[model samples]
Target: MIPVGAYARVSEDKALRANAADWREIGEQVAEQFKDMDALAAELGVTITRRYNDNNRPAGDPHIVRNDFEALLVDLENGTVRGILFYHSDRLVRQEYDAARINRLFQLNPTYVGRAVAGGTDLSTQEGRSMLTIQATMGGMEVYSTRRRVARKNKGLAERGHIHGGPRPFGWAEDRRTLHDTEAEELRKAVLAIPGGLTVGEIRKQWIDLGYEPTRNKKKPGTQTLQHSTVETRLINPRICGYRTYLPQAERRDAKRPWMPDFVVRKDGKPVMGNWEAIVSPEEWQACVATIEERKRARVEGRAAHTTSAKYLLSGIARCGKCSFPLMSNQYSKGTASHERYGYRYACLTTLGGCGGVTRVGPPMEHMVEEAFLLEVRRSLGTVAGQVEINETKHDVRLARIDQEIAEVSERRRAKRISMSTALDLIEELEGERDELNRQRRQLVAAKVRRQNISPSLPEEWKGYSVSQRKIRLRESIRAVMVHPAGRGRRFDPSLIEVVWIEGGK
Candidate 1:
């Protein structure tokens, strides 16, 4: 027997958490057979190649599909090693998926098929081939059966018209776990604000800003955000929008209403909505679509996600109206609570490692920015007119559009012309679009506020802003404000804050 590669596939998701030890024990037993074959190879003046035993990850999981598996497959075919060593047939692959993989192994290396306990299988012998076929079929059937059970459960759920959600995807992974209303809102916002059409790498970074990192092993990042690939898969998935979609092999016969009990198809050419809770609102999903469109525009222009100037509640966006560079972040520690608070101060934009016409400033300087940037705007707008008129007009236009679309979709539903599934999809699309517009409108309103003679001055009450208030302000203003511990982690002084605007002019 030549050396062999063996593997078992495990989905790195809610799909499956553990494998049966029975499979592993069999693999150990099979290795003994290969060890015996090693001696034979030595007697024939040939060296026994190495054995590759692996844990299978789902193809979607970055770690599952290794080049090494295919590499070993090739070596076995080319006689680089004797044959693959595995515990059992399913231990190798659950199904005979055709893709120039193990199938090629059977054709190219006719004698190279190796398994743990196959009762002396020899493809050249009639007795052995039959045993091999049975084992292969058994393994494939096991996978098929497991999938069937899951499909049945999902179909049952869809019939109830309740929103159904699974282990949340990457960004929303902790939604149910954390159960914070704010966190859920953040998830919606993150999805809504996404530039859409982003690769797995792009939106993941955004999700990370909200404090969830991909669980990657061996430097391969896993997906946690809604990416183009995610969206692509999701669009066709009946589960996301509430239906159980499956391709039944039984369909080979006449169209039998997809009567697999576990599988679902459009009924009478109408879509069916399941009885699961919709975690993502229709409005939010639409914002994601708009973002996807924006992402497409960015990609076509051949630019990476563009980096823009940082903004905070007020000050960071102002710049040293003189220097034009982003404002610097400042951090202070509480001696009593041992917690940290953050603030922002602007320095000359021309300055790099050192300050030009600018030196370090303390939170005392915060008041100056507040007065200059915010209070000044409020004062200026006090003398200006038409703020109310402009605000009302814009709000009316946005409200009108949302109402129109919602009404049109509702009419389609009343007529019972479309399937419940299509009706749901239309609603979701309309909802998402509405949300994106609302968010945009909110931003415009914030900007208009900033434009008016809004009170930018720190209130006399806020002049008493403590470390905690500072912390909230810091978080609200910036996604991240890096306070380089140049003075070591012992004490944070003159920290560099990277402020990002959440809303408004900033």
Candidate 2:
């Protein structure tokens, strides 16, 4: 018997409507469709040699890359199969372009043919091609119809003051319009407390402490936590203030113009009040918004969040002598009883995590290190600065010469005096020299400027350097400042601090 191939497709959306118990039921449906193709093959006196089934697949677009369809096409082109069988032509292709592709294949391979079991259509005949084309056109129309139906339904639901379909919001019941009493009460209490100096982070911690659980939604499975961002988001939503803002899918896609969920939409020249109870007054909501803004300003200004405007002098350079991990600066509140004792310290990550025990007081250690560094710089400033200036001048002169040579070579190449290959080689050599000189010039200029910026005669010039500027100066001379902790209850010692000097440093 002549070998034939069979193809079957069933979309996930269709199987879901059929009330498929699981993927197994969908697989059974696919197998049943293949049996129909097998029956057709038996009638045609051809054995069903290979079967291709695309379960949970979309056939609306010809441009979509279907794995099984491509494989079947590969087999057909290789002349492994003389005929192809399908449950229906629409299952093989829904788009007109896909139908044209099938027609092209039949033209290329005259012996190859397509037969659909349901419609009894054949690709080998003109009348059968017409039938397949009409079926595909109708299938494409059905996709558009489905989309229009969904769009109309969603728009109607939105006008009725309800979200089309999504997971229920935190304070709302499954019906959406009705508020969940307990959740609403908790939310109201949280929002009310925000302006009273309680932060979003603090509110989250309070909710966790009180053992508050999140509302369960069928659409979103898994336990959810009341995070700081979540609290901040809930506080800012206008839904709690009794207004609905209709944000379409298109509006949400424009990232530059992000849809603010807290904004109230005007309908018929008036604000559309949501058909839900308000959790808090609009005035209270605005207060919460103001509080969040104030917190953000404070963090950026470094008045909060324990960050310093000045760079920590030894941030990346300092390492724990025991674990070899970089030391991090720890900031403490000012004017505490132990402000002078523990205000600032360089604490190792390993030591903090109980891997080792090494920490250094920031102020005293930094003061000692800087005093020693500056003294050394003062001793060699004249000799080092003069050499850097001379090297910078030499690099500039050589770079000018290299540029002139490159221009001469390019002009020669354009004039056809030298072969293209010879001109390219010379130009490449000159460009390399120019790059090297530029790099050297940058290094020498930076060194010269750094020395000029530092005035040994004026002690105040040293203090004028910002935290980042001081770090740059220190890095040039020091590789690492390895801190060995002084024993517990012992006096601070500069002898314990080991400053490893960088190679060729001042």
Candidate 3:
């Protein structure tokens, strides 16, 4: 009927950001620390009633109300933990005040923070008190020793050219180059259809229309599953092009464990460049990788233009859906007006004056509808800002290699290594690679061109320009603006405005 408690602290280096818990290691450690308490309780015929553990926390971190460890410490103060027992003293208190309080729970502690009730074995006994003190000191040593061992082992592994284990890489089997013909061929098709080629959208559309299905997730029929980004990554994978890479450290929160020392391994259980057939040529792979990096650099170095006016926020996108028409925007005329409101509305255009009249819209009504729609959108889909990261060096090397291939091919033709027909064939081969590179190059070139030759970014309150100027900027940035007419009035019904797939977060 007596209650006793157990307490434990894990080694400090534990981090749970990887979404994995070393629960097994933790359980074992806790058992080791509380071993005495369990034995003592059995001897006294008392039950160990509670256990508190600081899981995945460093000892030095602040103990806050929201933190689990803080809650456990509070319980200790309230006598919920009869006589706090832990593997060690340092675990209970890294700071002096904390350690002193924990040591005072009982004249003779039992290493068992067992029952707060009266029937537990007497901790005031000489043997019981000594046993608890020895265990705490031992636990402290264990923590320090564990850290030193790990650091030494890691250093040795790095020197031996061995990468630590990590997430399975694509194309290879669990970090090995073992062959899986089916998946390999799928990868082949993916890289072959690179950027600007039948887009993943086009490829999937063709596949689905012809009744193709993936081995996984087959329940959903007629749905295209090749996301644009996924296919894009396949095209740039070094393995696809026959070269194996060693990514000793590639860790990002969204990416595989970033900053963690890991080596590139084939999917099958071998090292990269260990054993495998090259899927795509190195040249093509490099080209794709290069373009990706260039685009990323441009975007990162490129700043975003700020929009200050509400009209600029919803301008081209706020359209009516009835006839798929865009609503015209106008402000209140106030040169001499007594009561003109200053708001914006998107009303469907009226028919030719001969037949009837233009539809009318009011400003305040437009704001009401726009704000409500925005609120709903924000609630349903949380605001997200996606960042694009690229391995710059990898991409740069890839692009240079592709350019080299093209140059080398041209040089061979000039030297007449083969006949005209053969030369033409070689040129075609090189041209294929060149064209791929060109597409990526064009995207970058276009960006630079826009910066140097094109007009500056337009202002939201572009009262400086006429409607004609606004139309030009809209054409530059927008694909289309559609509007639907409601039965009555100059007021735009926000319900009729349907915004389609957009690139960034709204």
TM-score on alpha carbons, each prediction: 0.38, 0.46, 0.37
**Which runs of model 1 end up more than 4 angstroms from their true locations?**
1-49, 59-64, 85-88, 94-99, 115-385, 389-439, 442-506
RMSD of each: 14.0, 18.9, 19.0
lDDT of 1 by residue, 20-65 (tens): 4344233433445456555544543444456554433333222245
Ranking by lDDT: 2, 3, 1
- Stretches of candidate 2 above 4 Å error? 1-6, 10-32, 47-58, 61-84, 100-107, 124-138, 180-266, 271-340, 343-506
Ranked candidates (TM-score, high to low): 2, 1, 3
lDDT comparing candidate 3 with the true structure: 0.46
Q: Which prediction has more favorable TM-score, 2 or 3?
A: 2
Looking at candidate 1, the ten consecutive residues that score lowest on lDDT are 480-489
What TM-score quantifies how close candidate 3 is to the native fold? Answer: 0.37
TM-score of 1: 0.38
Best by TM-score: 2
Error of 1 at 475 (Å): 22
Give lDDT: candidate 3, residue 409.
Answer: 73
